[model samples]
Target: MAKPKFLIKTWGCQMNVLDSDKLAGTLMDLGYEPTPSEDEAEVILLNTCSVREGPENKVFTELGRLRPLKKNKLKVLGVVGCVAQQEKAAIFSRAPYVDLVMGPRSIMHLPELLEQARHQKALEAEFRDDSVLYPGGKISRSHPVKAFVTVMEGCSKKCAYCIVPFTRGREIYRPLESILSETREAVDSGFTEIELLGQNVNCWKDGATKGFADLLEAVSGVEGVKRLRFTTSHPRHFPLEAALLMAERPNICHYLHLPLQSGSTKILKAMRRQYDKEWYLDLVRQIRSRVPDIALSTDVIVGFPGETEEDFLETLEVVREAEYDAIFSFRYSPRPGTPAAKAEPVAGEVARERHQRLLDAQLPIQTRRLKAFAGRTIEVLVEGRSKRGTEWMGRSGDNKVVNFTSTGQPSVNTYLQVTVERAGANSLFGKAVTAKNEAPGAKCKA
Candidate 1:
C-alpha cells in the first residue's frame, strides 16, 4: 500500500510555477507523493498556459502523448490553469482521457474536483469573486532564497490582444493583511528576497486610499526582508510615488519590468494599451530620474494586426531610446476570443522578420548596459551554482544575473560583494570579493 504518486508538467509564467507549487502542496496533503517521471505516477496534471498560440498547442501535443499512458495504466489525467479555463469542457471532447479541468480561480475546489473525478469527469471553471486570494495552504516553494508572493491575481485591463481577461477573469487584489502575513512567513522561513507577483502588479490597491506604493512601503518595513521586487507593471498604473519610494527605500529592489507593447501611438491605440508612446517613455524617464541606478526591462510584441512598417520602426526606435537591460520580444499570435483575433493579421513572414529585427536592434543596447557593470562592485544574493557549475550565480538588486568564481564556496542565500571582471550581453562575469552579512547603502559602487 503505497501513497499515490503525482507528476505536474508546468508551462508559462512565474505565476503558473507558483500555482504548480500550490497544486503539489495540496496533493501532498492528500497523502500523494510527487514523482518527476510521468510513467510512475498515478496522477498527471498539465498546469498550462494559453497566453499565446504556441504554449496552448504544446499542451495538446503533450496530452496526446499522455493518451497512451492513460490507457496503459490506471492513471488520472487533468488540465489546469489558463488553458483549462479557456477551453473548459472542450478539453474533454478533444482529449476524452482528461479527468479533471479547473481554472486559476477554482484552485480551492481542487479537493472536491479530485473526489468528483474519482467517480466521473469533473470541471470547475467558475469565476468566484470572493476567492481572489489563495486560501492558506502548504506551499512547496521552488526557490530557497527568494519567495514569490502574489499581491494580486488576474488582469483588469481589456487589452485587445490579450486572452488573460477571458482565462483568468477580472482583477482581484489580495487583502493587505494576508499579503503581510505571507511576507512575514516567507522571511521567517529563511527567504530573504520577496517578489510580489500579479498580472498588472503596480495597479494593486487596498481599499480606496492605499495602493501599490503603500504596499511597497509596508513590505519594506517587514523585518529580515533583504530585497523586495514586483513584476509586469502596467505603464498606465505606475505612479511617480512608486518610483520615489524605490529611490528612498534601500530594501526595495531598483528593478521594474514595465511593458511597452508597442511604440507607435497609432499601433498602441489599436492594441488598447491605454497609454501612448510619450506617456510610457515619460514614465520611464521619471523612474530613471528618481532611481538612477535602476535596471529596466520590457516586453515587446511585433506585427500586431494592422501594424505598418513605420509602426515596427517606431518600436525599434523606442527600444533604442529606452535602453533596456533585456527585452522579451515576441511575434504576435492571435488568441481565440480576443478582439484582435477577429481582425486582419499581419503576414507570418513579415511578423517573423519584424520579431528578429526588434531583437537585433536591442542587442547592442543590452550589451552596453551589462558592460557598464564591469569594474563595479555589486551586491549579489547567491542563488546557487551556475548552469555550468564552474562558478556560483546570483542576481543584483537590479535583477542582473551575476556569475562569479570565489576562492572559497559562498553559501546560497548569502550576500556577496562581487567586482565584475567582464560582462556578456546577458550576464556579468565576476569574482566574489567578500561575503557580507549586510548589503551596503547602494547596490553598485565603482
Candidate 2:
C-alpha cells in the first residue's frame, strides 16, 4: 500500500496551531506524509474556529468545494477545533461528505478515526468536559526554536457574546509536572522559546498548589529555556501576582495580550466581561508600575449591538490612553446561538466606519510610542531573512518585528544586537551593531 498523505488547514488561535502540529505528528508516526495540496492528500482536515461568522461559513464552503475530490477517492474529510465542537452534527448534516468531526481534545485519536473514515464511516468525537489528555510523543513542531505549550484548556466564562464556553467547554489546567517535563523536553529538542497558551492564561489553576505565577517560575528555572511568553489573558482573571512574576523574571518577555472587547462599562457588562473601565485601567496602571517597559497588545470589538455614539467615543478614549503596541481590532459579527446574535445589529456602513475610525485613532499613538526604540541597540532573535536580501527579520523581546542587515548569514533563534536605523508603521528597520556570536546552550536554527 502507498503511504498516506495529509493536509491540514488551520483557522483559529495559537492553541489550534499547536493542535495542528500534534495532529500532523500523529499522522506522520502512523506512516503518513504531509502534502502541500489537499487535492493529492488521502486526508484533508479543517482545523477550524467559530469565533466569527465569516470563518464559520468558509468551513462549509470549503467542504463543498472539496466534494468533487472525494467522489471516488478514499479521501477522508475531517473538521476539528471550536467549530467542530460547536456545530457537531449540524456540520455533517450540512456536508455529509465530511468523514470525521473531531474537537480540539479529540485529535489524539485522529489516526484511528482516519482508518474508520477510510472504511466508509462517519463519526463525531468531542469531549464534553475539555479535559482529555493525549500522549505527548507525536508532535511534529512547525517551528524548531519556538514551541507553544498548552497550560490550560477551555474557558468557563460564559461571556454573553462568546460561544467559546459552549464550544470549548469549561477551563481545566494541565498538570504542572506534565508542563515542566514538556518544557524540559522541548528545550532538549532545540526549542529556546516556550509560550504558555490558554483561553484565559492568568486563570490557570493546577490543583490547589499552582497558578500562572507558580507555573512561570517553574518554567523559568528549566536549564535551556531562554525566553518565556503567554497569550490571551482575561481581564477578569489578570492577577497582580502574574504581573509581579513577569517583573521579577528576566526570562519572561515584557509583554501581555489582554483583550478589551469594548471600552464602555455598559457595553462591557452587556458582553459579560465582568470587569469595568475603571478596573481595566487600574490593572494597566498596576502592570506599568511594575514593568514600565512592557508592550501591551489587545483585542477590540467595535459597533457591538446597542453600542451608542458615546460608547464608540469611549472606545476611542481608551485606545488613545492605552496606546497599545499593536491592536487586533474587529467589527462585531454575530454568531448564531450567541447572545449578541439575537440583538439588532448596528448598520453595516456604521460598523465599517467605526472600525476604520478605531484604526485611524490608534495608528498615530503606536507610531509615537514606537519612535522611542529608534537609535537604540536591542537584541533580536533571528527568525529568517526578509524578502529583500539586504535585510534579516526577527522579533524583539516585546515581540516587535525588527528588520536589519547582517554582514554574514545569521542563525535563526540566536539573539543578535542590532542598532535601529528606521521605523515603519509596525516594524523597526535596523542594521547589526555587533558581530554574530553564539550564546552557550542556545538552540540556534536556520
TM-score of 2: 0.95
Number of clashing pairs per prediction, in order: 0, 0
lDDT of 1 by residue, 211-232 (tens): 9999999999998888999987
> What's the residue-level lDDT of 100 in candidate 1?
85
Model 1: residues with Cα > 4 Å off, grouped in runs: 72-74, 135-137, 435-446
Off by over 4 Å in 2: 72-74, 128-132, 387-390, 440-446
TM-score of each: 0.95, 0.95
lDDT of 2 by residue, 1-446 (tens): 77878899988777888888888988899899999976678888999988987778899889888888887553788999989988977998889878899888677677667877777656888474433355454678786458788788888897888888888878878888888888887888777788988788888878887787888889888887888998879888888888888899888999899898888999999898999988898888899898899999999998899999899999888888777999999888888788878999888899999999999998888888778889999888788777676688888889988989888777777778999987889989898876565553355544
Best by lDDT: 1
TM-score of 1: 0.95
